[model samples]
Target chain A: MTLTDESPPMVNQAPSVPATQTVTLTVNGTAVELQLAPWTSLLDALREYMQLTGTKKGCDHGQCGACTVLVNGKRINSCLTLAIMQEGNSITTIEGLAQPEGLLPIQQAFIDHDAFQCGYCTPGQICSAVGLMNEGHAKTTDDIRELMSGNICRCGAYTNIVDAIQAVMHPQPDKL
Target chain B: MINFDYTRADGVTSAVRDRASELTAKFIAGGTNLIDLMKENVERPTRLIDINRLPLATITETEGGGLRLGALMTNADTAYDKQVSKRYPLLSQAILAGASAQLRNMATDGGNLMQRTRCYYFYDVATPCNKREPGSGCSAINGFNRIHAILGTEAGTPDRSIHCIATHPSDMCVALAALEAVVRVTGPDGDRTIPFAEFHRLPGNTPHIDNTLKDDELITAIDLPANGFSKNYAYLKLRDRTSYAFALVSVAAALEMEDGRITDARIALGG
Candidate 1:
């Protein structure tokens, strides 16, 4: 649900603007605190409040996967969940994927296969791929395609995206 | 969505008490559908009772050799659970065939049953929808009605007293209907159980009421029968897209075969 902290009991009718509550969220690797209204979504908290623009907002209604992020290592539409409800949970965004040394395997693989053309849905695609691997469900190419159907590339980059994810999922041995 | 006060319910008793006290306060579990409705102005709850922290997310075996699915259990977990997939594969397949991986991860079992109809007129406040506002008028009755209900309507009657074309948009309920599961709910008054077949009501005169659930009642769990249709079963969903789309027409069939002969069968259809 959209995030909103509860206020003290009102003796009279509730006011138009409810009181903003303090919500602590563990984003990427840091614990950031913010005063958010009850209607603030986690996606809005990340992009607007925390300045983590790496996570894009495609369809805020959960129809598109562009707003996806890992909540406790499981991918979910951040736009649908309220920031206040995720207090005790650990959230991972696209910015947290790569190590300090280099890019993540899926991120690098995307570049190698030219997985994205517009790059609008790339962050969500990469995060979803990481979640898919953790889930350990995808086996065949069809499985990957089916599981990754939520992330849509309007530029028609399905073939390359599938290739990139498959390459990361099943890496080939280097030749001598 | 407008600003609403939120409270995290500690237990089922407190949750029910809170709901019973307030008429406009809604319980927020997954918020997958509730938030969408709130954004569209279809639902305007002044206060929201967050029940995500409730201790009802477990799946336990019943004394009758059945399975009891906790109301707060995520659809993804229930579908992928070893006991569920091994014993009730039809349910697992049906849950997987409905929504995307992300939605299944957030949507809870109880919330899945509470999904509103996807009828365009119902969501649009401008249109005249009887389900939205009774006696206003049914927009789908005469307007573009491709996704409306085919049955449970009497268009040719002399005087149309009972008429609503909206349909409940859920794929999991179809399998539950075929399996004859039981819905356990707790209300301010007490606890009760409702049969799956009698849970959802047709769009009769009162189309606004979707199910038989009381205003203050909370679904605690869903009890599955011993016969889970683990074998000799099939779930087919015909949708516009192969994945991440609602079903146009779906069917769930389970058969009991004795020595290659069909002894019994259960079948249910959904749209």
Candidate 2:
């Protein structure tokens, strides 16, 4: 392994493919075990295998937060992380955002404030908003907008989305 | 994405040894950049040595009155960390200005330094890119290169043969350059420290060589010196949109002001 400038790199030396991989996760309060390819992304695993179709896959890249999910309480792009990498962790998707009895506060706020038009990016928006509020960063309306910029609302429903989030963060006297 | 063998590294030693043993073996933490490029087929690793489980996610105060950030610390966590926000607000601001809330949550500290250029030619396999393929000609030199480099490329002479002109699209690295951060890496031989400026190389004749790090080296931490940059500093990023857009050009400036006497300054630019 001489690293001199003269030697050509040994990148294409071998055909390195692995067998099927397995990963277990506490997804949406359920201990779900999945077998998948090593290259399978968390987004694909959630939507395709686990059938958690609520987490939409828009860009299939990290650019759009359509596949945003909370991994161990932190919001991350599910498309960016490999499914096998998240072995000993918990995953919370938009489908799991709702409580057993009823809708979560953020979900209720989105409904009350009319936060969706076509409702395509709503799941990602709600999930990311939940994580954002848990992060405890956004204070004012501008803060909410700035922090929520990751979840892109393609239908131009950003104004109502901000209203929905702001209402939850600082509830009105009677609205509460 | 191509199929690849995967192994979770036991520790730093094993990680370095595995990477040193195979040239195509890659250390994956956060998997934000590596997996993205793999999806695009821009980079194909034979084996991925997952380093996420490594105990490298602490942000501790160094004895030298500065912060030593763990390599695996996410950009969002580092930006909002109390120590980073208070002592090195410039770094926090820069990280915040680069990626969105979700991307920052996924992108790691060392991964930010390792992310490749957003050059279209490099991403597109059909085009001829010297950076992507060593002997191939650069298409961006003759084609649409509005978002390319302006400073390091032969200073406005499009007449000469341009090797490669793609710019590093990192806002965190820009701030790291201004802060004069030191990158701590552990390789097969031993541990070595690389200065931030020398870490990223200009796309000169050898446009393929992205950075100065050895292929076997694994970045463990970033050490910041005694920060005289807490008071007067700014990270201004000019971009297409307000958020979720790569910067067209960005500037990170830190000034040391003792009673408004204009003592010292550090400035770095990026795109």
Candidate 3:
């Protein structure tokens, strides 16, 4: 048998469909419009189209939380949602988390607690933590650990990550 | 993923009409599952009707003292809803037991019911999967069948020959079945309600057909009866990991007790 890159015959390929459509998204605080293909994921639209590469794509599928972003203040897997579907929603990526004056409290906490080794999963972890705080569900260390379990740290920086989030959730004056 | 035409449906009637008019059109709401399937080439809809704009994102109370969860309501919202957590704690617990927070935020209640199996072979296009392709034969039957269904197999039911062993992979649906929730749907034929137990089907001769939903039918809402078993209920999930993992075996159990004795019991399993 010869090697080929073709898909199976059962897969239906729509060739005559319109290639791309324009969608307006409110990222961080600014609204921008971009023309994108229907198959383009929100992750790709941010990384490739809008030139915002802060949101990492660890797994294009929803398995990895590396592409996690806040949509209207709720964290969602950007890889799972289509870019066109997210139109009119307010999206916040890691790049958008920091303010012009200084870094967000979570970012400073991550740095203070040494929450990262390779730093690939930090963005997602921090964004997920922000989303967790927004939801106001985590009340304890265990709650922080459970709520932030979506972002995986292959470097095994889980302990520091949890500490960083817990510190933010329940801040001690001395620690601060 | 294959390129497809995208159109936003302004209303439920137009959405149904568009879906019914086209054979390969699909409705997209919280595209957590459908997009995953599409990327894997397991699904190829020529046209996608974005149903996120539809007015099916509310949770209302029914006349029977039950709750009606709109189809577009996100799983996270549904689980965290005050009414659901108070009255339907079983459903809330089950929803929380599955998936990560990010996924729960994107997955809809209707999409959760429409979730496909997590069978390894079903996702591998290189392998022959009866669920992915009709009459293609099941690879999980004899190959690494650890996560396959333990009940409702061909060996267990002689009358209904099972062609596949894949199990429904939703933790929320397991609780819904135990609670006897009703699924309200709208189609070209009009509106109807499907009993939760009858919504999902066992993999029989045709494993490709996952649910009893007809073509062009759209799930409008899921109604939970007044009896939510909030006082006595449990959702247990065993998997490779505690979070962000598919369940190897899960159980949603509810009970009605009288004088510390079980009067009525309902249990549903998922994998």
Candidate 4:
């Protein structure tokens, strides 16, 4: 009648491994846990740890927009933000812009219009463009130029980049 | 890059007060300017105190009818805030005009105010710069002097001297200067306010010291005065490129005219 032998054995485990300063952040709609150094920039964390190398690191000085990303739906220079500073924040990198199966509408538009050349700055350009679309301050091409000015394309494909962005908002009948 | 100790402080008090006695400490908000400087060895703090998590990210209405901008509020937030857009249009416009959307989103008001000048000599360790090292001699005086200041320089002084002229870096602060903004600082003693004009110091005799802030002091907030001029202000920046480039010369103006005669005009220039 005694169930002592059937009961599971309780193992006294060694002290649980000290929990790392795990940052729980939502990246591209999926929650992720990352242990990062306090001084590791969000750009370095994304590129080095998460392997999201799409976000380039041209200047790493905040002078170049090659590392632009959306934190909580707002475009920010990832190089300027520390990873620990974004512990509970929502992050969206260039890799997150597209749908599961195919490219997002903006990516498609960039492709159709040949918005990039050499493609070094494409990820930042696309991410910045997405942010620009939601920004209320940009009204015209001039405004777009001013707003998009931060993301530098050494290829000098700005005219096409602007064209690609405009093509999405005002679809051309001829192109369609 | 050299490795250093990193500490994250929960609040302003701990960040400034609990500094290691033997080590130099820096309070980093937005790494926009600091990181670059660190990499270049311009700022070699033995310990970095991360203050980004502090509860200082609000743009509120002051009791005296002005705006109180929290130190931790990002530049983009202040620029896009509805109240800031409507009331201090100059500030909003200036903020938008300086950096790109991405940089602005990461840059905080406190860090923006503390940004160093874009002086080439200052950034180049090989070059002589009094601001970088006192008595190093100025290279810009004999070298590339095109971007150097002309308005504030004194006669007979070294052309590259920090005194009389060193470019005031912030587009936001330039607007604040014209709008007569007040900077609120929280020190070991308590909270205090300094006028915008007095907040930044001209190099004069000591080009090494930039602002009036003490080592233990932290800028808590910036309060913009409520005045008729603020409602009608505007900002114009002239830069080399259409985008991300720094200003060659910029102007922030708030003018009130009655019958075509200037009733009041507030102007702050940046070069």
Q: For this target, which candidate reaches the highest lDDT against the unseen true structure?
A: 3
Q: How close is candidate 4 to the true structure, as a TM-score?
A: 0.88
List of clashing residue pairs for candidate 1:
A1-A82, A3-A38, A3-A82, A4-A38
Instruction: Report how far off residue B141 is in candidate 3 (Å).
Output: 0.6
| Residue B207 displacement in candidate 1 (angstroms) | 0.9
RMSD of each: 5.4, 3.2, 4.2, 12.4
Winner of 2 and 4 under DockQ: 2
DockQ of each: 0.36, 0.50, 0.43, 0.21
| Runs in model 3 lying further than 4 Å from the true structure | A1-18, A172-176, B154-162
| Residue A137 miss distance in model 2 (angstroms) | 0.6
Question: TM-score, chain A, per candidate?
Answer: 0.88, 0.88, 0.88, 0.83
lDDT of 2 by residue, B145-216 (tens): 988887756756642336788888899999999999999999999999999999997666677888989999
TM per candidate:
0.94, 0.94, 0.95, 0.88
lDDT digits (tens) for residues A67-140 of candidate 1: 98999989898988899989989999999989898898889999999999999999999999888887888889
Using DockQ as the measure, name the better of candidate 2 and candidate 3.
2
Candidates arranged by DockQ, highest first: 2, 3, 1, 4
Q: Which ten residues in a row have the lowest lDDT in candidate 4 chain A?
A: A1-10
Give per-residue CA lDDT, model 1, range B154-211, as digits (tens).
6665423344688777889889988889999999889999999989877666777788
Per-residue lDDT for B20-89 in model 4, tens only? 3423577888888888787787776656787878899998889999889999999999988988988888
Tens digit per residue, CA lDDT, model 4, A1-176: 11112111122334333334676767788887888656577888888888889999998877768888888777888887777778778899998988878897779988999988899889988888888876656668888788888888888888999988887756632221
TM-score, candidate 3, is 0.95
